[model samples]
Target: MQTKPTKSIYWGVVRLLGNNFLMAATDEGLCYLQFHDANPAAGVDEGAWSELAKWARAQLPEPNWVEDAEKLQPYILQLEEYLKGLRTTFTLPLDLRGTTFQQSVWRVLHEIPHGETFSYSQVAQELDKSSAVRAVGTAIGANPVLIVVPCHRVVGKDGSLTGYRGGLRNKEKLLLLERAGM
Candidate 1:
């Protein structure tokens, strides 16, 4: 059976914290938060704006993409505040879509609290899925919302920093900002 394609409302792209991200909203809520330099030629391509949307769309199920920057203002402003150390928690509505297990992992990630770290095993234990430690790691790696979802808070059991899609530099900056109580 063929399922109908999901529709997407593009909230436009914005650069934040020396990185470029593409934010898109759906009727369900904010769906895509992608990291792509806006321009490789200019060397700002940590995650370019246009290329990100293409890549993000390709990764997820197809959606009828539309443009609407105004709807993205609140999220953009909140991100700016967080980067500036004036905000710690995100209140923006998120329409995160993933498999049931992935969603469960993401929800736990959200509860990790600011300025703290959790090991993959710790997260699995918290979810009472202790045997799924590796699965937990995979889910965390697949986190779509990045900082807002707090995947950067997950670390190796020994407290070593792990791989982050936004890059280790950005993760370090976030962890430092949180640790400084900024």
Candidate 2:
């Protein structure tokens, strides 16, 4: 039986950079980062604002304007601070969604540490098959969670910004933000 996709509210702040982000959860745990610039899957309703905010409030204990109190709020705040050069690292629990290989890539992305960036080729080598650079890019792109997973830190072999599902401008901004300090 095909149950219709339920409408879920994704909530987050419009960062100083003018981006709308929300850490949204499903029955499966925190599942996605809603980025305004990206084209979202149409099958899943984008959901209603007040409805989403209300739902977001219900799910998280101390929901921020971004919605949901779960660890995601502090994560966003600290990330905002970090982008402003007030923080060096992100300390928040994540609810990642993906296959084992994708999860493995995400784990590696987190440990990439603050202020450092890696090339797609380098990540592929770390994943154990140097030849999997393209696959690494795919996995990186497949990363549903941003910043927390730090996909923006991954760049092209030539140190040029590549396609960031979130928008390459966002990618460049993040890189510049990190390099500006730590």
Top candidate when judged by TM-score against the true structure: 1
RMSD, candidate 2, Å: 7.5
Clashing pairs in 2: none
Instruction: Report the C-alpha lDDT of model 1 over 1-182, residue by residue, as the tens digit.
Output: 99887766665667776766767776666666756545423532443445546555755567666767687888888888988788989998988867799999999988988999999999999889999999998888777788889999999999999889878887898899998983
- The top-ranked prediction according to lDDT is 1
TM-score of 1: 0.83
- Residue 10, model 2: Cα distance from true site in angstroms: 6.5
| Distance from true location, Cα of 45 in model 2, Å | 9.6
What candidate 2 gets wrong by more than 4 Å, as runs, is 1-17, 26-30, 37-72
True-structure RMSD, every candidate: 3.5, 7.5
Q: Model 2, poorest ten-residue lDDT window?
A: 37-46
The residue-by-residue lDDT of candidate 2 on 1-182, one tens digit each, is: 99555544344434345656645654344555645632223222345344445544544434434344453555567667876788776665555656788887887888786767889988888889799888788899888767767898887888888878678887887788777784
Global lDDT of each model?
0.78, 0.66
